[model samples]
Target: MPRSRSWLPLLALLLLPLLSAIATAADDTRPNILFLFTDDQAPWALNASGYDQAHTPVLDSLVKEGVYLTNAFTVTPVCSPSRASLMTSQYGSELGITDWLHPQREPEAGLKPGTLTWAKVLQDAGYRTGLVGKWHLGLTDAMHPTKFGYDYFMGFRGGGNSPKNPTLEKNGETKKFEGLTPDILTNHALEFLNVDSDKPFCLSVHYRAPHAAWLPVADEDWAPFKDLDPMIPNPDYPKLNVDRVKKMTREYLASVASVDRNVGRILNLLKEKNLDDNTIVIFSSDHGYNMGHNGIWHKGNGHWVLTENPPFTKNIPKGQRPNMYDNSIRVPTMIRWPGVVQAGSTIDKTVSNLDWFPTLLEMAGAELPADAKIHGNSFVPLLKGDDAKWDNDFYAEYSTKHQSHTHMRMIRTSEWKLIRDFLNEGRDELYHLTEDPAEANNLIASNSPEVQSVIKQLDAKILANMQAINDPVLKEAKAKSSN
Candidate 1:
């Protein structure tokens, strides 16, 4: 061979290793993910979404700096099922976790040990995973966060506890904190962020706020809404007692305000550490809440006070039905990714908590297992301002047959929403959302052909979704109908 040919071979050998190193570094430059989850936060609770009653200055600022999803929803309105769906990217029916995981009754009900979560996937892809707040999925050793993927878990294992001076569990050890729950959790999350690690990190900071027993928030947090009579849904609904509604609203908003303050603290830490640019921050809730909306308080199977007295009475009648109303399922969702996701962008298309699984995995450059059956489509294209085709419909299921609520399934589109109570002898609810966004009117009794056609269409969609998820309730309902 000639000298020129030998020189060419040597240059190729040297450049090949350098090129491989560059490729490896580029692939490892995945963004760190910070997910901020709240409990019982309604879609309209944020000031950015037009609820001025809420003093969420930090979240509002995030809305301006991120993509606000106007129609985001949870697969189930309850905590465990919704959180399970978020982690597994599947419906609650598919996971057989239709109700909140209770410690005494269903201690073993949780994501299976071998289940694939976005966190686990990211961890497999070389990301550090940590959870610093509420983990309602399970309490058993086999169902623990560490059993699944998280390298660090420091939070409560049950549904919820008092926001003040609560006990927390960390790596098989339990300890009590002296400060507020949100503040303490935020401090732990900040500590997780400060952990010296070269690998990218994924931290989930779930807060128990604005849930039931909504008292004892710091006085400063309650000061903003204490004197203000926050707005209630469907004020004209005769069954609703406006006084009780106003009081609950004040307490709920105060809790939300506390959460907002802590959110600001987290955001400030990211900026202080100069991690804002490379961090993908998300803010959302487990599900929505109803503060006297459609004559209900709390979530699934919500009750209302019948009389204006010191001792309140629940107005539930025999065979009473709970509902999956918009106020109970729709949640405020926003995402901030510095250069990839456009700032101040709002997506009106319907999206679900399930979508987060696939979106985060895609963003982290993680591969989905071949056997993994994910029900959510990745919305990363939408975040990138691409002309992506998106789903316009949503499906939600809530099964509390063992609780006070009846089993409910819902299908909603842009213009219409249909809610079916499988166990209730009462009529289903059909609303034309364009004409009535508040969902105050039910057109289920209408005999008009157009109304019937829409109901039929939505009912078919619900059945199809049920079949897709192998819903046992649907099978039972079908058996009953056949008989």
Candidate 2:
């Protein structure tokens, strides 16, 4: 996770009891967390069924059993930085992890070998941790999960998975399978569970499905959907059915279906172990994709001002990319903590991937360090139906591919969203979700003063969020640069 958030003495001293009671040696308190994170999945694409054509049967069922947050977001919309944020509970700005698939292809990311990960905190406080699939943080062995508190480590270390070159490592031993992706990963996770029968563990089951280079699921599983959209698309952006695009989306769903089956398998294993009642299941994705939404193919790429070939993805200038719009940042958050959280409940409160850290900490009853600085706050209380006023806004930032001054930052609430960019005239984009739910109109600089007033409110929200997670280091650097 990148190093953003806040550092201060924990105000709630009473949380110690809660921590100890909930966390076992390796399984922290508040039910074992099974965080199922996928890549490039849109909230709208998840089991919308007739509304949208995506097969996520297992995820669909899981959402029905518990709470589904419609407005969940990621701090950064890309790969490495987003997961880093989840692991550390800090935004990339805080962690200094500004890019995905970091240029250095190490094992655990650039994170220090012995640095205490949020997982380490849980493991230290009494929880067994296991992470499976796509650890794209840094590539160094020192960044490996086993040393960082996870008892098990089996997955790859890149933005996308390669079935042919699938790298599965157990402890320090590694195996590269020239086979399928989900099969290899699911087997690795299953192998870990099969070996350790009794330890209460938190497994972060990451599926690189619905991502690029989409492939079909195992036979008999996705065979049902094979006919749904047999063709797949290439990596080209914005086209729904160009070349392999349709096939790719189909393959994406097939991959998702396979991942779902794995989820089912894992759940069955838990139930077999009588751990279902004591577990929490969360399903989400890092960011979203543009499947022909206004001719946008992928994310972070925008249409040019005049050359209208469609903007989701294009051969654009290196530094210029799309703004930090909600479509690319918003994701589905389906959580099930049976008996503790409401059944079939839908919470519209704005949440971010950063919240996962502190939420897990609070749930497990672990002690946060006095000097620990985290940007995210715990939403566990809200999940439990406690009427609390959580923040209405979540923040998102996106930097250009070339690391130029082309950057965008946004603050989004339920009914409104504001994107301010130094690149686009600090071009402020304002959206009134009440009318334009899809965020089509820019209310900023509109004719109506009332519409323009929302821009002011949004501007204020962005500044407040910035201050909430402001790092003195970065602020000093910015000030220095300006001077």
Candidate 3:
């Protein structure tokens, strides 16, 4: 009996080791996800996007090695709503986050409790998830990144942070990090990658660089732009402040250069850890930026960068030029999936920030919860370069409650764009996008029957989108139109 019992124990020990090995093997098959995001990055701000003045070598390399999405855009061009859409695949208006969360004015505003994010989905599906940098969604305990399914979070919970010596939250405590902000964030990202485990991980590195206050970068980043006068997107607009635009352009490009430098660090780390092949790297911005584009300097809620300004209207302030310009909504986006996606591939299909949720879930082999309500489709097939039927039409919305006032909704196609300002009368705009890529011409006043017919069809599409979301402004907009 004792001899037989000893053999049984030996067999049990051998089986335990084998089972553990099998489990680890299964986990290793799942790819690690590294999502690198930036703040206020314009699509043309990259060298890869043909802006030769922009020094984004690392990013350009990523584009060469992966898939560059030429027409990527965000649902809302502001920080909070775009982040919300990226996280949950829901529009900003639906989540009641139509504007950037102002820390002082809107203390209680945030992503509601129990909101299911893609991070949570991946966490629930056995992947260790983390978000590093810029969670502008909420500033309270209930809306913390951990609450949104991030196993670890290290960044500011507000709209802005200093580019140098930023006070960031880390490991349940706020710590002031020394050095340029981009470098500091990347250092921490490297630490996260150094983990010695077989568990699949999903990490988001959201850089606050290139947002604003774009200075104090490392000398290496600034050297290229130092004493270099950068070209303004529109230097000839009336009273355009060419000098001011040039100064800001130099500063902005320097800020973008800082981000590119840090990205190089992250990519090197991935290769060093031998995780390059097994990891999927994605790069994008919260939304596109505008530096003197259409004579505007900021995003969705744009500000006129002019020596003289437009007069104050019923809804718009004197300096504010609230708009739905393509540059404000379009973002720079790329994805590097080694084995799955072919190198140097380019996808011109229109995709929005909303698509990231379902796309990431599908990549992770995770399923969306039965009750999950999302407004985006998975773009996995597009990434794989499949000949899948795709839609180039999309809708965008922005309601600037703080800086300005307007319920702006847009319907954009390859040929035309229609923007309706529901709060203000006669502020509608229509552009033939193919002929007028700069959107310098507003044909909203045209009485041509052809133009009117196109507007009618596009207006119907916008209303349909609003109705589907049960947009809160729909009733008021309808009433105002009728009056």
Candidate 4:
């Protein structure tokens, strides 16, 4: 062979590895993200979370095959605000969404355009993003999910919807889907996943089940709980309606099972598509629910589930029990990262919905804008089981303007929790969480020096957190106190 020809073969040998690496790099799409979110799902709603009565086989399996976050919570325990915090990594107050948005009441209210969501970051980084199911943040066209980084959105922009044969928006058209709502939502989600694309994708499947009107579930979904007697959290509480609680429990678990079934379908599809290995599956809820827990039955703006509710107080209507209960804040959260997170692992560190924004950005290897401001730290290290510094202290706020009028701010540590209702006098509460995880004992008025000391410390921290965020409630509270 000529010298040139001989060198060509050697050169080809040297370039082969480089060419192969390039091909691999091109084919290595970033991990697809499947965020399955539920509405009004309590942290203990799943059997995997040790609630034996609940049938959530799919989610239980995910917990076994992934990292179960035992202390995952949302900053705000309402629909709109919690979701806003998840999208922006900022508190609901910071985003002007302190409560669930009412389409008629706040017709102009919606997520502000230009908000930097992790989805937008991922989308900018070449990932296809879609949101299916609920988008309660805003109702206007300007507040559409697509405006907040979703490439495609097929769900209601409002807070509530029927459980079956519901009307949902798809491809800019509001059409009625005939079937169980969860099944219908999952059907569209599967369609989103079936799209032929090489780009990585992020799909948020937000279910409105397990919320209210929790009925008319599929026969299979309802079969397990229909006739079964379920346990109530606290049947001995004053005026507690045991029968009502059990009935709601059965219905709620059935609704949750519907979500579980749909989740199974999604998982199966991911495996069938060979995307499971490369996809990150996260299951969580907008916020936790309370079904007769502490005699309350709702989310942040909870309602008294008593046979006879307390009389109407100033600003608080009859039956309304606005609160910052753990049952309303803590959520059932698990993430299955095929290779990164170890199977059957658990993280007890406190993480909030706010953290997801930065965690996902980091997960996608996407960068935030220089001017973006977020209030959450990335828990990616925790996900990887790395020994990293993690603060277990959590701060949360809820300013209910619709069902009730109150400014409830909370500071919770591993050992203690304090909730101060700034707007409602004598409504403050303090709990030694280490001793009373149920928050049954109200220690705010305790005479003990230790209890008082904790109250002072936690109250100060809550104020500091509010000040850090320039919470409007602080100014309002100050004015009210002076007046």
Best prediction by TM-score: 3
Query: What TM-score number comes out for model 1?
Result: 0.92
Highest lDDT scorer: 3
Candidate 4, TM-score vs. the true structure? 0.94
What TM-score quantifies how close candidate 3 is to the native fold? Answer: 0.96
Give lDDT tens digits, candidate 4, residues 1-483: 535566888999999999987864674667889999999999889999889999999999999999999999999999999999999998888888898888788889978987888888888887889999998988878778988889999989898899999999999999888989999999999999999886888999999988889998999998998899888888899999889889989998999899999999999999999999999999999999998889999888999989898999988999999988999999999999998999999999999998998899888888888999998999999998899999999999999999789989999999999999888889999888898999989988889998888888888899899999999899998898798
**Global lDDT of model 3:** 0.92
Q: lDDT tens digits, residues 303-401, model 2?
A: 322223333323234423465566678787888898888888888888888888888887777788777767788899889999998887777776555
TM-score rank, highest first? Answer: 3, 4, 1, 2
The backbone clash count of each candidate, in order, is 0, 45, 0, 0
Candidate order by lDDT, highest to lowest?
3, 4, 1, 2
Taken over the whole model, the C-alpha lDDT of each candidate is 0.85, 0.69, 0.92, 0.90
What's the C-alpha lDDT at position 372 in model 1? 86
lDDT of 3 by residue, 1-483 (tens): 435565887898889989988987897899999999999998888888888999999999999999999999998989999999999999999999999999999988999999889999999988988888999999999999999999989898998999999999999899888888999899888888887777899999999989999998999999999999787777889889888888988999999999999999999989988999999999999888888999989889899999999899878889998888889999999999999988899998999999999999999999999999998999999988789999999999999898789999999998999999888888899999999999999998899999999999999999999999999889987787688
Worst 10 residues of 4 by lDDT: 1-10
Worst 10 residues of 3 by lDDT: 1-10
Q: Write the per-residue lDDT of candidate 1 for residues 1-483, one digit (tens) a residue.
A: 534566888899999999987866785578989999999999788888788778999999889999999989998988999999999998888888888888888877887788888888888888899998888888888888887789999999899798899899876899888988888888898999988776888999999887766777878898998799778767877656888888888888999999999999889999999889999999999999888777777776566643532332143354233668788888889999998888999988888999998999988988888888899999898888888888789988988744554668899999999988787655489999999888888999999999999999999999899888888988889888999
lDDT value, residue 309 of candidate 4: 87
